[model samples]
Target: MSIRANLDVVHERIARACLKSGRDPAEVTLVAVSKTFPLERLQAAADQGQMVFGENKAQELDEKATAWTSSDVEWHFIGHLQRNKAPVVARHADVFHALDSVRLARALDRRLEEENRTLRCLVQVNVSGEQSKFGLDPSALAPFLEEVAQFERLRIEGLMTLAAPTDDPEHVRPQFSLLRSLLSTPAPGGNTRLRALSMGMSGDFEVAIEEGATHVRVGSAIFGNRSYQ
Candidate 1:
């Protein structure tokens, strides 16, 4: 299928999921994960009205943002971002999804302040308790939010998580439930800036949508499988 055709199918699925959950389809935003997919592929998705693109690497993001100079595109840095790469991510990204530490937040805030830019960010929570995943522990999220609130330029919009990969999407439902629950709970500083749930991906976004995902980062579904060879 063409990118446009694939996008239509994805949106239809999102709408169906939203309908099933008694929510507005408009509430969920589809972020086409464009990492490792080259500019030509991005152009294909963009041509089909995909406004938001999620890039996982710092260099890819910087290059893509420069190459695809469409003021319409919203860039989301949806990966583990290091402190050293913070300045570059801060410069190119409109939303930073994996904000797991104070040091990374501080680094991003410092650069945003220098450039007179404010970046919307989501606290990445390791909901599945995977050591390999980079996010704050569920127990540590509220305090982390309280500590992060002091940064002037970074707005802690909500929470994001990558559920444990599974064959049956139902297996990861609890992980998504946990993340939604965290979003509802009040933070220490009354920093209840919670709304968006940046959960879900190509494999299990429907389940994420049902669980209350505001932003779904879908890559392979809409653009087809990426080739490394």
Candidate 2:
């Protein structure tokens, strides 16, 4: 299928899922995951009025940020961020989606302070209990939040997670539910604005949306298989 055709199907699925979940179709934002895809594909999506593009690598995003500097695209960093690379990420990303630990958050916070800027980030939760994933376990979220909430440069927008991939939807549902439950936990001082849930992708975004995903990361569903430069 063509890129546009894929996008059409994905949008249709999102709409249907929204209907089932009693959510407004317009309320669910589609973030095209452009990681490892060509710049032409990104331009094509832009032509189709896609404003948000997510990338998984700091170097890749830095290159895109330079090449597509003229385009009005909202770049989101949606990969596991090492503390050492936080400064580079701070330079270009509009939003950081995989902020899993307070240490990394503090690193970015320090960089933002030097750059005189603030960043919007999601606290990535490892709801699947996957040791391979880089995210805070649900139990550690409160202390992590408390630690990072002190930073003036970082704004905690919401939570994000990658459900462990499984063919059966039932296996993934708990991961999604755990994320949703964590979001409902009221923060101290009622200042935590947990509005965004960056979950799901091409394979399971519909389930993710039905469970309360405000932002879904879709790549292959829209762009098909990515071709490297």
lDDT of 2 by residue, 1-229 (tens): 8777777888899999999999998888899999998799888888878889999988899899889957588899999989988987888888889988778877998999898888888989899887898888888888877777788888888999999988876679778888998987666533257888999988888889989998999998898876775
Question: Over 4 Å off in model 2, which ranges?
Answer: 189-191, 227-229
lDDT tens string, model 1, 23-127?
Answer: 999999999999999899888888888989999999999999988776899999999998999988888899999998989889998999888999988999999
- Candidate 1 residue 189 C-alpha distance from true site, Å: 5.5
Angstrom error at residue 209, model 2: 0.6
Local distance difference test, per candidate? 0.90, 0.86
Taking every candidate in turn, the Cα RMSD to the unseen true structure, in Å, is 1.2, 1.7
Q: Point to the candidate with the largest lDDT.
A: 1
Backbone collisions counted per model? 0, 0
TM-score of each: 0.97, 0.94
